[model samples]
Target chain A: MTKKKLIYIILFLAPFAFIFLSLFVGRYPLSVPEVARILWGKLIFSAWGLQDISTTIVWDIRLPRAILGALVGGSLAVSGAAFQGLFRNPLVSSGILGVSSGAGFGAALAILLFNTTSYIYIFAFCFGGMAVLFSFLIGKIYNTTPTIMLVLGGVIVSSVFSALISFAKYVADPYNQLPAITFWLMGSLASARYQDIMVAGVPMLLGIAGLIAVRWRINILSMGDREAHTLGLNTALSKGIVVICATLATAGAVCVSGIIGWVGLVIPHIGRMLVGNDNKILIPTSLALGACFLILVDNLGRVISGSEIPLGILTALVGGPFFVYLLKKTKGGGW
Target chain B: MPLVEVSNAGFGYNGRAIFKNINLEVREGEVFCIVGPNGCGKTTFLDCLLGLLKLDQGDILLGGRNIKTIRPPDVAKVLAYVPQSHQKTFPYTVMEIVLMGRASYTGIFSSPSPADISIAEEALAIVGLQEYRNRPYTQLSGGEGQLVMIARALAQKTPVIIMDEPTAHLDFKHELTVLETMVQLVRNTGKSVIMATHFPNHAFYFENNDVPTSVALMDKLTFSVIGRPGEVLSEKNLKSLYRINARVVSYQLDHNTEVKQIIPISTLYSKESERVN
Candidate 1:
């Protein structure tokens, strides 16, 4: 590997090391050896008799939350990379097609009207399906593949969902559900559980794998629709499949842990800048870097304030200015 | 049998007719050049042949069958196209880009086979871009990029190769190089090549080659003359198509010299009467 590749691998691997250390070395400190023993013992026999309190804190609380954070972060980044390639625009993210807002609306509706069991997962899938359907419909109606139409469709659908969410908020009792809705919108992995992991992890993992497998096709599509078709690709069908797959992954992540922004938009750009624009390299690199980025951010959220900060706030705080700097540097040339 | 046939074909977009009542046939092992003014439906016609655009009126027969009835993959198996210019957003290498031409042959999940790789390499060598195989396609110069596009078409290994303005942005040397490559491709492989260009001099040069020949010169709006080079590329025809009073310049062959005559229509004159009182 080149020096740059080596450095990126080190940079990406660093955060996992820090997170592993931080998991045990907190306010209730456990030695690194004890942490290792706990992990190994749990893997083999399911009970490490060192301390019940440490087990609960490490396995029950922090571990699932951290894993959820990594899953969501990686899904968003991979989705963004696929979207950027599909639309041939560097600035696009998973949210460019109204996916997040649509999922938020579906979750809000489920919370308000259905109030049924496991409504979060249901709402997420429904919203994602609807967003993809609308995006395709709008693209078809326009008869053009210009990115502007997709963005406009996203904005319009997002506005509709935002209005619905606002209405739901107004009618919501200010005591319980209102707080839940607000917190969910703000985005957190604080309430993450083992069940959440199973629901979100499977689809996110599948999505990331699918994107990697189709990475070369995505690069061909980035050349434009005509070139792709002439290259013996069924451009429309392939694009639709990719969009649906990406939305499924994003929705799965958002179902468990609300709308965590910026990781999707920022990490892929960083991946491209560091590794160059080949999707074969960029996809895997984005996954690793995204996982690390979110873990570090989540750890910072935990450490800096003595109480956990919402992941959305932390991501925006870090991603916003960095995005501006990248914009300035690229000067919109690659788009 | 003719390799490609357009039987009274008509095509239009959004109800605006671009071309109507057009008919042409390209035989095997011929360099058929279509030349016309801007917006004269040259690219649109090529699109129809490639099945990218549906014809409004008639049928295009490829290999003596209606193109619409043939599966797209099957059409791709026999015909390949090189676009005028391609925009590069991702950094794919020249090898990767050329390998994409083999997509019709390769399975969906399988990588390009050894055969595919060798074909791509052969294409690169033919286009004189073998040394640039590993270079990022976006970093190539315009002429080099055009050559790579040709390489990609060649990699398809199809019997019929269609090109749209393959030398549009090329300099003088590259222009001659592309035309020369096309001539050699037809001569060596007996592949039918159809290309649309603004320059008719290229057609004149190709027709002068010592091979069984078929050539056509098409002008804007409705004029076509198809025959041997000396008959079709007369000064009257050249002046009419280009709308310039051109003097035909010929160079006699010295001993052991094989270069043919070249006509340079350098200046164009306005329409005026040459009246006798």
Candidate 2:
């Protein structure tokens, strides 16, 4: 095999390795062999001779958290890559259209009104989708100009939702609901469960599959609308599909993991540096690298202190410095 | 019939007329040049021909069919565009950029096959950029970038190519290289070229080719004359169109051959200098 193919193979395997390794690093640590035996027994014999605590740690806590981390990481990075290509700007992220802020507002509102976790997830997902849709509609009002206007609309919607989130914070019960809302916005996968994984995994996977299928066409889209139109692409339809897929993935991720930042913005740039700018390869590369990166960050967050650090803090702390390093190294032209 | 025929085509935006009574024909295997000052609607006319913009008054026909009837992909199949050199936001390799020209041939969900790769390679060879295939497009010089775009159009395998200011940002050597490449495409591959340029001399340069060549001198959003470059690009027309004092001179070579050249002397209006005097 070629060297590049070998590199891709190694990159693809890294995520699985991280997932397996992270399954043993949680607050209730399980040995590697014990975890592996439990996984193998669960998959095959449906029963493991391992202790109840071991099974609980592996099956209930670590597995869901790791899997959810991988799913959210992969989806966010892929969606971020898609948006960057769609906008023809490397600085863009999956949250460019106010999805994160909107989801934050929705979660805050749920905390203030319903005080229910499931309601928070549902409201967050719906509001995230609505935020993107609002931006798209505002952009449509000036159909003659698309990309710039859409960006502007996103800015407008994001600020509005941010204000709403602040308002919700003010009205929230300071001692009871306020901290909960604040913690959720700070972002963590600490409470990830199998149900949360199943609930959010489906849409994230669908969005990922859709992006992978249309990834090659995104190269043409990055050429700008006029060039894409001249190349015979239905610019509006292609762009709309990309935006929808990205929104669905981002919404699903935000609903489960809260507003985990930096994975979407920085992982794709790393992927582009490893594999060139061909979206066909870049999308998958971003998926694998993103999964591995977020899992590593999550593991670090749990193990670094007595209290588990929020994922948003660790990701930005790690990813932000790495991004600066990449800028210095590649001079911001990794593509 | 001409390969592209724009008959009485007019285009306006926001109820303001930009151009009207525009008529032109690009025959097969011809180098058709449109020369006018900036903002004379030359690019708009090309857009109308590409079916990107609908004409306000009349219609454009390609292969005797209404242009609006032909879908964008089908139009792309017939005509390729080489736009001016601009900074690329992403640093795609030359091969990747060239392969994107085959997008019209491939399905939206499908990747380029081996055959498409070969075609792209062949196009790179045509533009003499095969050696630079692995290089990042952003690292290429202005001239090389323009050549890569030409290679992309060549990869499209269209009979007609539309280039908007292909040599605008190039140095003198690059401009000559682009002009020579245009001549070669017309002479060897029998591809028709429709280029919008501000340089009347460029139109005249291609006029030296043996294949058919035509020039359209545009002014006030309409073609003042459209004919053989030698016939249409006269001193009087150049002066009128650009509001400059210039001469279309013929220079004799050592081998008893002659070449047409446009030399501008001065601008018609020097109000600032006049006021100073």
Candidate 3:
């Protein structure tokens, strides 16, 4: 095989290795052979002879967390890449369409009004979708420049939702619900369960698959609207589809993960560095690298302290320094 | 018959008329250059021809069919466009950019096939950029980048290619390089070219040189003159349209070769300053 193909193979396999290795790492700290044996047994013999505590730790806790980490990270990164290309700006992230703030507001409002986890997830998903809808509607109002208008509309919607989140924080019970709301906004996968995965997994999978199918088109869209039209692309419908898919994936990720940041923004650049910016390869590369990065950060959060550090804080802590290093290395002309 | 026809095409936004009463025909295997001062709507007219903008008054026809009736993909199959230089957000390779020209022919869910890849390689070869095929488009010089775009148009394999300021931001060397490539494409491949340019001399590049070319001098939102480069780019028309004191002169440097050169002897304001003195 060619060197690039070999590199891609290694990149793809490295994540699975990390995921497997991570299953053995945690507060419980199961041995590798035991973890493997249990996984094999569960897959083959249906967890009948596996030890109870090991099974619970392996199957119930770490597996779901790892799976959710992979899904959320992959979704965020792919969507970030998609949005960056759609807007033709490398600085854009999946959150640019107001999904994160809208979801944050939804969670905060849920905490103040209902004080339940399911309500938070449901409200977060609904309002996250609503935010992008509003952004699209606002973009359509002008009808002349869709990309610029969508970006402006996103900024407007994001600000309004950010204000609403602040208002919700202001009215929240300081001692009881306030901390919960704050923690959710800070973002964590600590509560990741199989149910959460099943719930958010469908949309995430759909969005990711949609992006992959149309990933090549993202390259065309990045050429700007006039070029895309001249190339015979239906600019409006294609952009709308990309927006919907990316927003769905972003909303799904935020609803489950709370507000994890940086994975979407940083991972795609890393992917671009590894493989050039053919979205066909870049999208998948982003998925793999994002999964690995978030899992590594999450693993650090689990082991580096007495308590579990939030995924959002740890990602920023790591992503911020790494991005600076990347900037320095590339001299700001890498793209 | 003309490969593309723009008949009485007028375009404007809302109620403002950008350009009107535009009648033009681009025949097969010819280089048609549009020359006008800035803001004379050269690009607007090109956009109308590309079907990117609907004409306000009349119609554009490609292959004798109304362009408005042709599907966008069919229009793309017939015509390829090269826009002005702009910063690309992603650093796609030269080959990748060229391969994107086949997107109209490829299924949306599919990528460029081996056939497409070969076509792209052939295009890069045509532009003499085979060595730069793997290079990042963003890392290329302005001239190289413009050539990559031309290679992209060539890969589209269309009969007609439209360019908006193909040599706008290039250095003099690159400008001539692109012009030679344009001339070569027409001479060798029998392709039609419609280019909007700031330089009237570009129209003269293919003039008196055994090449088919036409010049369209635009002024006040309409064509002032359209014919052979030598016929349309007369001293009187150049003086009136550009308000410059210039001459279109031919220089014979060799026994069998001649070149047309636009020499500016003086500016219109020079005589005014002399009178003031």
Candidate 4:
């Protein structure tokens, strides 16, 4: 029990440590005392006369990016863990409900029509939410929303939105809109700002908090509907809560982070290995571990090349091989 | 008063009647066993009694209240259910699985408390799986899984437990072990067990008990006969129910002990066809 508590302590603190580390290692790298002086909240220059550029770089640029990374990463990971439990499939991730495709299509359409960046977040969030609504309405074609029906609904909605995205891409301006849509679809956290936190990050925080608050029930939800019912669960209500929370998290995340994947798919599996399948603990652990992972990876992305490598590329690059190794080591018994 | 009562109970799908006009009641501290052939609505009947399926033409009462009137959590406090088997995708611990039975007692957004944990531990002790609490549920043998399920049911602390073919996949020794566990549960805890099984001998095992016992035979889609095991389990009834030519042989093992057995000689096979379908 003490060992488990120690693990919880470390996981809880890992993200903060990484975020702190990130504040010092940006393009305009600030030294430890210099960064600490800026963080100490006094604009006054020290005896060494640290430049205003250092303060602006650390406070305005790096802090928001790292915090946004933590929020997006935590949102995706928690929602992914919750969806896996609700759908009763280990391979299920945050985008299984068509949110990413919907958001991707919305971003492409906005790029094609308006040729501006301001409406992109709103369109992406709206369409992402609508896609999940379509999936939910399709699931309601039957008397009750069975997990199988929900999954099929998700598949149908996802394919429709993905085809729409392709259509938008085919007609976009070859020079300007095409590249813009392509980059948004590839996903990067480089555009993260405090305003992004005010807009999309609020929903992300709500989702993470909701999932963590109601996480213990995922254990009962994973036992299948009938068994959970027999065990006295209001399965419909429980499933509704999980679906709503996960959708909010995914849509809000896609709003700011573009179309990042793999973090949602792999972080929860890693969390399961660390904490077992008990969502009660795994949800919070996923939140913390996901924050740490994305910040570190985003820092790597920033420094890996002269031009920024998109986070979607980096996460998949790292996550795919690591998942293969996990599969081979555990022989598909990692959960 | 009976703990569970059903009157004129009927259920069906797509407006097709499966069974109707059934009447039965289970008392406290009694062992109630239902025996039937394949696809004879035994599981359907149990599902209706457990309130999973809505009864089309009748009502079931738990603790003298209509089952429909009681919420699912309230019904859970009065009755528990054990499935024939479960296929687990995630590797939840046995203790975690058993603690799931406390769901009714806990709040929706909360987990099991220390009190709930102790209750689960006691239930594991009842099923003789105390030392296996930390084991993964997916790795256990079939019989052990069934026992773990029973522990989960026991943790609910319900007065009545409903099981559907709790021993269908077990070997001879494991079957007897589960059967003994069920009987002992009734004898010691005074909790009524309502189970449906394919074996008539399973009902016979509940014979010679000091507590009240009921053996019910459901057949011919609508016909059901409930009585004492010795009174209802006759050779003629077995033949009519299962089309089996069987003998009920009683061996006097001692002055006060008589071992009753049902040995099937042949399947009548519709009594007219020489070809097997």
Global Cα lDDT for candidate 4: 0.88
Model 1 Cα displacement at B13 (Å)?
2.8
Off-target runs (Cα >4 Å) in candidate 4 are: A42-51, A326-335, B208-211, B269-277
DockQ of 3: 0.71
TM-score of chain B of each: 0.89, 0.95, 0.95, 0.95
In terms of lDDT, model 2 sits at: 0.88
Alpha-carbon deviation at B85 in model 1, angstroms: 2.4
The complex in candidate 2 yields a DockQ of: 0.70
Q: List model 1 lDDT by residue over B47-107, tens digit each.
A: 8888888999988998899988987667887788999878777666899889878877865
Over the stretch A191-218, how does candidate 1's per-residue lDDT look in tens digits?
7789888877888888877787777677
lDDT of each: 0.77, 0.88, 0.88, 0.88
Where is model 3 chain A poorest over a 10-residue stretch in terms of lDDT?
A326-335
TM-score of 4: 0.96
Q: Where does candidate 1 stray beyond 4 Å?
A: A1-22, A25-27, A47-51, A111-117, A142-152, A166-179, A320-335, B113-115, B209-214, B217-223, B238-244, B253-277
- For model 3, residues A1-335, the per-residue Cα lDDT tens digits are 49999989988897787788789888887887888888999999983775689998998889899889988999999999999999999889999989999999999988898988999999999999999888878888876657999999999999999999999888888999989989999888899999999999988989999898899989988999888888878788789789989988899999999999888888888888778789989999998888888888888999999999999999999989988887787765455
Docking class of 1: acceptable
